[model samples]
Target: MTAYAVGQLRNVQMNDGIVDYLHGIDATLAPFGGRFIIHGGTRETLEGSPADDLIVIAFPSKAAARAWYVSPAYQVLVPLRLQGAEGDIYLMEGVGSEHRATDILDVG
Candidate 1:
């Protein structure tokens, strides 16, 4: 199944810290079959204010995603992500195919 990780980032305050985290995060996601599907782009506001950044990543399976996230290497980056940005993150699984609610959460 395909899993996705989605994030909405606002008030990003730590520049250098996030940069470093991303460097390590990119490398960590590779072996787990993770890829960025959305790398944050512009959008027209329709209602409430939206965050400046939105990101989505796909993974082969929910287990693969979970494994990557809990791995020692990536776990260290969690705090950086939290302290650097104010946002919400969620995992959803695709349906009918490899993508299901279970699959979406599996992405790292």
Candidate 2:
């Protein structure tokens, strides 16, 4: 199933390390078929206040997402991101195309 790596980042420090991380991330993602679906940009707030930046990267599958996150190429950049941003990054499996809202009722 398709999966995503989502990040809710705040207190970002735009330093050289962060810039280097940005420069190197794409090369690492290419091999694993990961692409950014959302990167902190303009948004219309309809509810509670949200100051943190939201980032979402979609991958072919959970395994692919996990692999890309821990791969040597990407791991080297992890520290830079951690040093630059305070946030949480997590992987989540996606629902199939035929999924329905009522599907939650089936969850045990």
Candidate 3:
């Protein structure tokens, strides 16, 4: 199944560290079949608090996503991302085509 690395960012600090992180991220992603689906584009919040930015990257599978996140090349960039932004990052498993919301919910 496809998996995603989603980040909700705030308090972004644009600096040399972030520039280095941006420059090196693509190379790290290529080896794991990861691609950016969303990278801080425009957003509209329907409710609740809003984030400064949102990022989502898709990987072939959860394992691939995990591999990319922990790889040495990526690990080196981790501190830069943390220093540049305050946010939450999550690894989410995508649902298969056969999935149905009703199947997991009590419709009663």
lDDT of 3: 0.91
Once model 3 is optimally superposed onto the true structure by TM-score, how far is the C-alpha of residue 40 displaced, in angstroms?
1.7
Residues 11-75, candidate 1: write the lDDT tens digits. 88768778788877888888889899998566878999765688888998888887777889888
Which parts of model 1 are misplaced by more than 4 Å?
46-48, 97-108
Q: Which of the predicted structures, 1 or 2, would earn the higher TM-score when compared with the native?
A: 2
| lDDT-sorted candidate list, best first | 2, 3, 1
Indicate the worst ten consecutive residues by lDDT in candidate 3.
43-52
| Candidate 2: C-alpha lDDT | 0.93
TM-score (C-alpha) between model 1 and the true structure: 0.76
Higher-scoring candidate on TM-score, 2 or 3: 2
Please identify which of the two predictions, 2 or 3, would achieve the higher lDDT against the true structure: 2
Q: How would you encode candidate 2's per-residue C-alpha lDDT over 1-108 as one tens digit per residue?
A: 999999899999999888999999999999999999998679899999997899999999999999999999999999999888998899999999999999989967
- Per-residue lDDT tens digits for candidate 3, residues 1-108, read 999999888989998888888999999999999999999666788998775688999999999999999999999999988878888899999998989888679667
